[model samples]
Target: MDNLVSVSLRERGGRFHAVFYDPDRGQKWRTLRTSDRREANKRIRIAEDLVSRGDFDPWESPIPDRYATLRGAADLYLAEREKGQLSRNTIRSDRSALGGLCSHMGPAAKVRAVTSDRVKLYFRELIDDECADSTLRTYHTRFKHFFEWCRRERLVRRNPLDGVPRPAVSDALPRFLSHAEFDALVGAVYSDAEAKARGVVDGERSKHTSLHDGDIVWLAEVFFVAVETGLRRGELCAMEWSWVDMASRSIWVPANRRTYSDKDSFGPKSRRSRRVPFGAGSGTEAVLQRLHDETGGKSGPVFVGQRGGPLDGDYVSKRFKEYAGQAGLSEDYVFHTLRHTCASWLVMAGRHLVEVKEILGHASIDTTVRWYAHLDPTRLNAAADATFGRNGDRLRQARCGGR
Candidate 1:
């Protein structure tokens, strides 16, 4: 470890950088990690060693600065995420939440200067703005994670986020459409656009042909598949034609996403999400299969973009909302509602909770149970009726009447 001091750098941002020290006439200045004293000093030693071996083309780090800005850290995090070793959605969320912090603080603000008071204030502002506790918690979680990453990278000496309390949201059961409501929504989709308040279609063909019911019908179909299959939005969008066997009444979820570098990247937000097994009636599966069969075969996407490309999840949600509106539903009831509805309906039909959990592809039966706990009352009522006896009163009356 050579004594490091007297540094000078001409530029800062990726690749070759030179920091000079000692006698100034060394001429061969070593590449510094960054202009920061703490960073340059730490790396100067390593660079000197690397120089001795002639492998001195500096390490080239994703971290631009030791104490990085929220945006910079998130960018680095995203780069690491792009390496395909972690969940893409998780990294995406980290970027989004951390970027929100950058929006509050200036983009170039340093992470070391962040304080517990500032974090507290941010959460308070969230409350004042009427953000949901769940959403607020998401922001805090992202912040906490960023700070932890900072600690590992030695950006800060101590974790200011350590004592921070997390916001608690009620783990309420999901609300789903009733059977009649589900049917009404389905009917609205399969019915006339004008009748369903889906408005009208464009083009000269408007004089005769109508396609208003198409949107709702499709949404309903998508909804049914969600509740029945318990597939996430990302999983549902990735479905291919070959994955469905309507005659056998099954949909195959590959549990992978097509990445920029990797093919069929592991999916479903987890390694366990690698596959989904589900059954659908010919009414839903048949139509989807027929559409693909009519066009080509099992090679292309089952659900395609307007230009016949892969369907993005964002686009699907937008379309799902517009289609759901015809059934007099709110944005509160999005595509995910179909998933809840499926679990709720199954519980209502007297299926076992454990069975429901497995079918839904939940990480734990506890999660499945928690999400549908509101449906427990229905389960309990039937259970009580069967166990306590629907004829308990009759039996008691016979004794009272001295029969």
Candidate 2:
């Protein structure tokens, strides 16, 4: 019925401005501060809505200019994420990446001022600093998300990272421990536990190693479960007793569970649930039983720290490195290597790729194949035998004249 708000392009700098009529202040116009016609139109709708509600303020810009700064936008984005369902580790990672970006490009830099060339330059500097390809990819992804948020909020006309190509990362095969190495690592855990019980001074023990015999057993079980079930460190740390079924020898990783304020929350990386089974004699059942007994058969986390709280993922990794070192394993080995070791062992044991995919909770079979298909040669050999092998056998018979 009425032309409540309209957007017009200013002739001076080609910037779009909002022109609106205010009942209290009579006819009024305010700059939308956006050059893009589409963004300006969106802001005009916002202004119309504000006017209809009788809260229009001509002096104050509809879009807060303060949030246009890179630092301000990043902080707002992070604060919003912190209030959402994202995992703490994920929020921490976003904070770290955004902090790096703000440091690299002066914090006061305007979000709209970021250009593709500037982003490329930042990446180039990162490359010069010898940042790993994976790390570079992480930074790129974080920046892309941040810019997308800015675009959605109308803080920027468009995402600056739209034209930038993602860094190419090498497809390195997953590393795994050999059987001998695995045995040695497990033996080292037991040895360390015994040493601690005997009060023997070992120079190689990590200063953080305050594990008693029970703690040592718990750590060993953590290693066994990680290598056998292929659970991620966070999943293992947040694993609850209810998720494990000793009778079925299965661990149910659930995507949805009621999270109490007193408990740490856990969700799989894929955000999907899957069951991981362990063999009867794999010692997994025994390990779970022992832990169950020690934890008083309560309905709480399966693994806990010295303070009877959820295990810290970082601390588990640190202790794993020390144990790996004591076992004379390669320095490159980390807790995730145990997951790789699990998949490798499963594939080598003739488990199907799809089965390994489900066991490892991989979102796709392609990922399971990419990491472990090569480890299982039986299927490849069988296929070759079914095709070329038959032909070769017939050719050999003909050549020898049925001798």
Alpha carbon lDDT of each predicted model:
0.64, 0.79
How far in Å is the alpha carbon of 211 misplaced in model 2?
A: 5.7
Model 1 poorest ten-residue lDDT run: 257-266
Q: Which prediction has the highest lDDT against the true structure? A: 2
lDDT of 1 at 1: 18
Work out the TM-score per prediction.
Answer: 0.72, 0.80
What's model 2's overall lDDT? Answer: 0.79
Model 2 poorest 10 in a row by lDDT:
1-10
Clashes of 1: 2
lDDT of 1 by residue, 1-403 (tens): 1343243444545434556444534534444424345545555555555545545333333223433666666676556555656655667677777777778778777877678888888778778999877788888888887788667656666776776788876666577888787777766656545544434453123444434555345555666667666777766666677776655566665544554212222365434543345545534565666676686755766766556665567766776676668668766887778778878877877778887876676767778777776676867877888988758898988999995
Q: Which pairs clash in the backbone of model 1?
A: 189-216, 189-217
Candidate 2 lDDT over 1-403, as tens digits, reads: 1354443434235667666554554655666655557756776777666655656655465544456788888877887786679776677789988888788889688887789998899899988998888888988898899889788667888888898999986788889999899888888889888887666658454545465787586788888889989998878887888888888899999886333224345577677999999888886777888878877656888876767777878778998999899999999899999999999998999888988999988888888988899887889998888888778878988989967
Q: Model 1 TM-score? A: 0.72
